[model samples]
Target: MEVNQNDHSYNPGDIVYVFYRNPHTQDVANVQSAAVVNNPENPGELAIFLYETYYPLTNDMAVYQSEAEAMEVYEQYFSFE
Candidate 1:
């Protein structure tokens, strides 16, 4: 299936960067490389595959096309110190 989420400017196989908060540590977060893919369970929707998990890809998500871009935003808003 060749699908493109034009609204989000991303499609299956697209590499994106996102902020991943450690599930065990509530305060620690890091930039992670993720892949955009068709959601197997949802069929028509897109999802972000990272760290062995699939997260729903929504318009509100802070997805970045490059690691540098992701890091910039991360430091600006998510960084504690």
Candidate 2:
């Protein structure tokens, strides 16, 4: 498993994009949401609550293959401002 190397940079209420792997099919879901818990006890990570509950983001859910992947999805859907 890849480990996060950067410092936690987001906070609760900040919108972020989480690229997750679907539990059933291993499909990628690049979704956006508000950060719920940034760097919980895990460090260099975050917990997000998806805007769409039909696809709830879980702690066990795989969020991005790497930081670069996450950033790519964020750039695709979210504004830098």
Candidate 3:
């Protein structure tokens, strides 16, 4: 199945940065390099195939369109750190 590259926030295999928090420790992390795996369910949703954490990367995670956005989102939502 051919996927529309622009349909989602991130395309499969595209190198992108994600801002997230550790589910267990609640430690916030920002600008983490990750590759978009697939959007098996939703068009704009994405799955991160690789990351530093053991937690499964889900579509609900805060994915930024750009590195600048990552910084902003991190501070806005997860700046407790």
Candidate 4:
């Protein structure tokens, strides 16, 4: 499925959070902050460079608009509240 880039509120060079399912943990996800490295000409395809891992992630992942938004997601799902 092609994602409408316009619908997603993120721009290149913007710092965004990406979500990935933790392979070591069951039923848990990990969040990482990365910079929007590139948005391919093909609509909906985005690449991000992660600072923590020093690698570029191009797989299908959820990208948040801002750190605050990512925090909200983590709090709602990952937090033990």
Model 4 lDDT tens row, 1-81: 333342575546677786766767878777777777554544455456664443333334667776788878878888886
lDDT of each: 0.85, 0.49, 0.57, 0.62
Evaluation by lDDT, superior candidate among 2 and 3:
3
Residue 39 in model 1: lDDT:
90
**Clash number for model 1?**
0
Per-residue CA lDDT of model 3 for 1-81, tens digit only, reads: 223333444456676667655667676454776766655555455566554333234554655556886777667876666
Alpha-carbon runs more than 4 Å astray in model 2 = 1-8, 38-46, 50-81
Clashes (N, CA, C under 3 Å) per candidate: 0, 0, 0, 0
What TM-score would you give candidate 2 relative to the actual structure?
0.35
**Candidate order (lDDT):** 1, 4, 3, 2
2 versus 3: better TM-score goes to: 3
Query: Higher lDDT: candidate 1 or 2?
Result: 1
For 1-81, candidate 1 gives per-residue lDDT tens digits of 443343447889999999999999988999999999999879988899998888988766888889998899999988678
Indicate the worst ten consecutive residues by lDDT in candidate 4: 51-60
Best by TM-score: 1
Q: How good is model 3 by TM-score?
A: 0.53
Instruction: Identify the runs in model 3 with alpha carbons over 4 angstroms from their true place.
Output: 1-9, 38-46, 52-59
Question: Considering only N, C-alpha and C atoms within 3 Å, which residue pairs clash in candidate 4?
Answer: none
- Evaluated against the true structure, the overall lDDT of model 1 is 0.85
- Please list the residue runs of candidate 4 whose C-alpha ends up more than 4 Å from where it truly belongs after superposition: 1-6, 20-31, 39-45, 52-59
> What would the per-residue lDDT of candidate 2 be over residues 5-56, giving only the tens digit for each residue?
2433334455545655466776455443444454445555555655433233
